[model samples]
Target: MELEGKVVVITGGSSGIGLATARMLLEKGATVVSWSRSRPKISHPDFYFFECDVRHEHSVWAAYEQTEERLRQNISVLINNAGLGIQGALDTMSPKDWLTMMDTNVNGIFYCTRLVLPGMKRMREGHIINVSSIAGIMGSENLTGYCASKFAVRGLSEALYKEVRDYGVKVTCLYPGSTDTGFFDNFEGVTSRENMMQPQDIAATIVHALQSPPNFHHVNIEVRPLMPKGPKSPKKA
Candidate 1:
């Protein structure tokens, strides 16, 4: 389907890939709505921001209502891009931290997807893109909760494709490796921000998937920097 004039809702649109995707979608003439706790830094006539904490069902419902009422259009695309990262040893991790991560990374997607799906199914046309991560595909040390949440997203993508494809709704799951984002602000051990992929790169890929033929489904996409770390220099003696 053509992107022009389409309405897209992106979660976590305040920054990172979500923000980049919003800008790119607007450039394609698509109406964009950003759902996040913080306000976006940019502005456009076609861009709309809804302060929402997707982890809560009521918040999502309200946001959905406002989006539809304001735009007077059912969403053509829903991007489950909001995510939280809380990494630590399993034993060291607190229950609150674990719940918060799942609430943001998994439940938020769940709440958002459920609210928009009925309309999409009724329209018999829509796209749902869930952003997973490389962690979802591979386990990482001290990242049990994060990995579990991403894996859940991957599972949702897999199941939803089979469940919704017959209704003319396309489902895509993205598994991206380390990117230069605030996701790593509280963590350490990354090789270099310069070596990671940029948000715009992911944004372009998302638009490409959306532009695919109706019969085609990108399904799952896994992207990473070819060289995530530079070659090591000689060590000091």
Candidate 2:
């Protein structure tokens, strides 16, 4: 779909990938609405900020409703970028932490997607982009809960893709690997930001996906950094 003058809704737009995406989309002439619990640091004439907690259905509904009412148009794109990652061994993980991860990463997407689908279906032209992670594709030792949440996102995106294809609403699941964001701040595993992809890189990929012809749909995209090879070990004396 053409981006100019289109209405786009993005969750978790306060920072990181979501914020970067909002800037990029705005540059393309799309009207951008950002939903998050906290206010984002961006200010643009075409950018609208809505405080919302995607984990709650009512909050998600209100955010979308207000956007539609204000814009008087159906959303052209819905980007589910709000998520949380808690890393720890399964036995060491707290139930509250587990629930938080599931609620934010899994249920949040469901709430936002459910609210946006009817509008897109009515218009028969829209795109839904879910920001998942490479952890969803492969299991890691310390990311059991995080993996579970992201894996659920992958499943939800895949099923929703097939369900919405006939309606002219495309679904794209982004599985980005180790981007240099605060997502790794509380992570217990080793973090090498120097070798990680930048948030702008993911934003560019998302813009590229959105720029695809209406006839083409990219169901899934995985992005990873090109890490330099470690030095070879010398022969033992």
Candidate 3:
């Protein structure tokens, strides 16, 4: 679909991949409505901002309503990018942490998708991209809650893709390798802060998928950095 003049809504737009994507989409001539709980310094004429918590249904609904009121158009693209991570072994993690991860990573996608579908159905065209993670596809030692939540998101986005493809709505779940984002702020590890994908690279892939033709339903895409084949080297070359 052509992004020019399209109304696209992205969550977690204050920083990281979402903010980068919003900037790129705006450059491509799309009207961007970015939602974040915390505001950022934005200076784009075509970009609109909405402060929202995706975990809250009321906040999600209110943000969308405000988008419609401002743009006078149903959303052509919905990017569910808001997520948080908590790191700990399953036995060590608190119940509160698990619930928080589930609510934000899993249920938040459901809430936003449920709210956006009716509008897409009425319009008969839309794209939904769920930003999953490599953790969603693989298991890790200390990230039990985070892995579970992202895995559920991957499953939800896949199932929803099958259900919505014939309706002119495309659903894609992107599994990005760890990127330099606040996503690692909760984790403590040697490799957590480095040796991962870049947010701009992921954002470029998203724009490519969004612009793909309807005949190409390239649904689930997993992106990871290429690891060295040789023995441990001092530097990556």
Tell me the tens digit of each residue's lDDT in model 1 across 1-237.
798999999999999999999999999999999999998887899999989998899999899989988999889999999998987989999999999989999999999998889889999899999999999999999999999999999998899899999999999999999999999999977667899999999999999999999999999999998878866788999
Ranking by lDDT: 1, 2, 3
Model 3 gets an lDDT of 0.86
lDDT of 3 by residue, 1-237 (tens): 999999888888889999889888998999888878987557888899988998888998898788878888888899999999888899989999999999889888887889888888777789999999999999999989999999998889889988888888999999998687777775675463556667888899999999998778768999976651323658868
Q: Which ranges in model 3 have alpha carbons more than 4 Å from their true place? A: 192-194, 228-237
Model 3: ten consecutive residues of lowest lDDT: 224-233
Give residue 27's lDDT in candidate 1 (0 to 100): 95
Clash count for candidate 1 is: 0
Cα lDDT tens digits for candidate 2, 1-237:
799999999999999999999999999999999989998888889999888998888898899888878889888899999998887899999999999999999999998888888989999899999999999899988889999999999999999999999999999999999888889887675556778888899999999999899889999999988772323588999
The better-scoring model by lDDT among 1 and 3 is 1
Whole-model Cα lDDT of every candidate shown, in order: 0.93, 0.91, 0.86
For candidate 2, the lDDT comes to 0.91
TM-scores, all models, native as reference: 0.96, 0.94, 0.93
Scored by lDDT, model 1 comes in at 0.93
Which has the higher TM-score value, candidate number 2 or candidate number 3?
A: 2
